[model samples]
Target: MGTVISRFLDALRFWFAAIRDVLLPRGCAGCDKPDEVLCASCTRLFRHVYRKMLPGDVGRCYGCSWYQGAVRHAILDWKDHGDEECDRPFALVLADLALKILERQIPCDQARALSLVAAPSSVASMHRRGRWQTLPLTRLMARRLNDHGFSALARPVLKLEGVQGKSVQAAGAQSRSRRIEGHVHVTEDLRGDDSLFIVVDDIVTTGATMGQCISALRAAGARDVIGLALACTPNRDE
Candidate 1:
């Protein structure tokens, strides 16, 4: 009953925000600059790409920017504060990162398709956000890849089970890792098991979630899985 009421309230909030937007236009999500969802200056901040290798032979993860200052504020607004308009700009940056990685993996004349897998949102998060945050970005990315002559498929086959509370509620890396353990698994309905997968996330913190995503994909028979985040936590101890 509580969950039902919570979802109801979230739905109400969603509609209210939509109505408000139609009534009074808002400014940029990264800053209060007028007439843009993301201004040029703010958009450039996402180009601060950084890479981190996973613990094992598992492939590396790339982040467009360190999660701090403007980047952190922008992500929080987009992810938690209902700034849906930021989706495209964020998608553009993520797609750029994916393309850069692809260049190194394959020759310019050779076009290779990859599976763009979005990190699964928990049921609670879906209810709260009234949408899957990463799904839109992933979909747009696949489209952008195809437009650029690379075949790509958006695969949202992973599902989160038995997880509760917001990721922010997790106390530390150990706590986050423990809570998510055994909770992420691939849905049996996914196709093309042998395709390379690029796990798409809005942010990478502690790297616990990305690691779990790779594990779940590998267990489901994926031959390769890498990660790309819009940003990653700066000075993350874990």
Candidate 2:
């Protein structure tokens, strides 16, 4: 009887959401046209493109796409606001970048052994939103990687504290500097032997957040941690 009630409530909630979406339909996040969340044309225009990573670049993490214009607004809407429809297109971009990394850099065998660690959403934000958005995006990317012959699993590794401030434009260089100061904690029991772990996030700003998360993973004994993200802001100097 309890299970039945729970299931019925879940169905009712889903129906309510459907009706709300239809009644308060949103425009394309990019072009603001009244219809789809992200119009087809915007998806094509903002297709994911790969960027090269240089050797011995510790603080410099590899990411795809410039975080500006459509990409910037889209990510803010999804991450800060509850723009749920942004997940699909965002996941597609992340998957494309991961594929590029697998093809040109990470070997097929190594890629298969990799575990994806999604940067944790803030506690307050999660409580308010009722879901960890990054987890779904991570799962979507993992499925794509697995389909392409990579063994990938999304693992929750880090947890965030404090209220998320207004979105700031972070420079890649400043991201490195801010790393030495932030206090982040790892809440999960991670295997030290998981040598190939990809830290996944929706976007990388100054990379300070990713750096803090990677630092926690390394402290927890992860052998090799690679940072991956859907989009990145261009450096201030760029």
Candidate 3:
């Protein structure tokens, strides 16, 4: 009964949001343009580029490139603004990146053995936004990857601690200066000891959050962990 009520409520809420978008028609969050979540030109701007993870890069685990430009903005809006319309676009970007990783990094057999793991948002953030952004993004990406002949599953493996803001500079400093402290908790036993797991997030800035997640997964006995983000702010070398 409770699950049914919850599902009904969610459907009602989505209906209301759809109505709101139809009536209000807000501009794009990325470029502030009219009539779209993201403009076509803006969408074209998101490019997948390789970025070297610094020594001890955490959020995106081993080596991965964060998607940038319009892709980043779309993710932020969906994540921060609770817009469901952005899911397809965000998933498209994630799928593209996943395909590239499969082709380039791991051997063909190893790529076939990997699965997608989504980082859970902090409880506070979910309460405020009313959704788990990473899960949706990961599921969408997984679907696309599956279509392209890669074995994939969305595993919610890491849970975040409550929301607490730290100085961006401080977080970045910690990522570069020292090891990340507390941030993630693993809740499940992942399958296949040899399988590579890629952790996905919407955005990564200081990498402190990702590092914490990686540490927890590593502690939980995950053999290999990789971090992937829709967008990342280049670390400021202080």
Candidate 4:
């Protein structure tokens, strides 16, 4: 029954996209280029990987692009402006980036599962958006990885709890840390799993949220937890 419903919803989404494209064509979500959802130029912006390490975390983090220019604009649309159309592209890009990161950072044991743990969404955000945005994106990334012969699963096991609204985007590192400090709660017992869990988020501004995710998951018994984001805000000094 769940599979059937999923298929039905997928079909509905497809038709809805087709209709939207035909009836209300718009310029590129990024850069306002004419007659494109996301232009090829904007897509090219994400080809490079921006890898970095956050403070007070055991795992390294990787991003597909610097969070600026077209990349930032496109992500904003997909994440905030109800532009669900960009989900597939973003997921595929992220999956590709993850594969590359896996190649460079971790050995492919084949026996171990690759878990994509999406960043937790707040109840208020979910209520306002009427969806768990990262859930589907993470699911798509898992599917993409599986298609490439990797055992991957999307797990929404992390929960953000007991915080005021809109707190993840605090200004500086200290502010960000204080806002989200101890608020990330792991919802399941994934501890001691023989899997490489990658915490995926849309953007990494101060590395605070990603660091917290790594700490929380590791504390919860996840043997390995790394951060993956669509874009990373470049260092301010640089």
Candidate with top TM-score is 4
Write model 1 residue lDDT over 103-150, tens digit each, in one string.
Answer: 775334434568899998888888888898999999999988888887
| Predicted structure 2: clash tally | 1
User: Measured by TM-score, how close is model 3 to the native structure?
Assistant: 0.78
Q: lDDT for model 3, on a 0 to 1 scale?
A: 0.66
Instruction: Report how far residue 189 has shifted in candidate 3, in Å.
Output: 3.3
Q: In candidate 4, what are the lDDT values of residues 1-238, reduced to their tens digit?
A: 9999999999998998889878987788788887887789888888777876686645458999998878888998887778887888888889999888778776677667998998986677777667778888899999999988899999889998975545344345467567678899998887568889989998887788888898899889998778899999886655
Off by over 4 Å in 4: 1-20, 57-59, 167-176
Per-residue lDDT of 192-222 in model 3, one digit per residue for the tens? 4666677886666656666667677777888
Off by over 4 Å in 2: 50-57, 161-182, 188-192
Q: What's the ranking of the predictions by lDDT, best on top? A: 4, 1, 2, 3
Reference-based TM-score of each model = 0.84, 0.80, 0.78, 0.87
Cα TM-score of candidate 4: 0.87
Q: Clashing pairs in model 3?
A: 59-210, 59-211, 60-227, 61-227
TM-score of 2: 0.80
- RMSD (Cα, Å) for all candidates, in order, is 5.1, 3.8, 4.0, 3.2
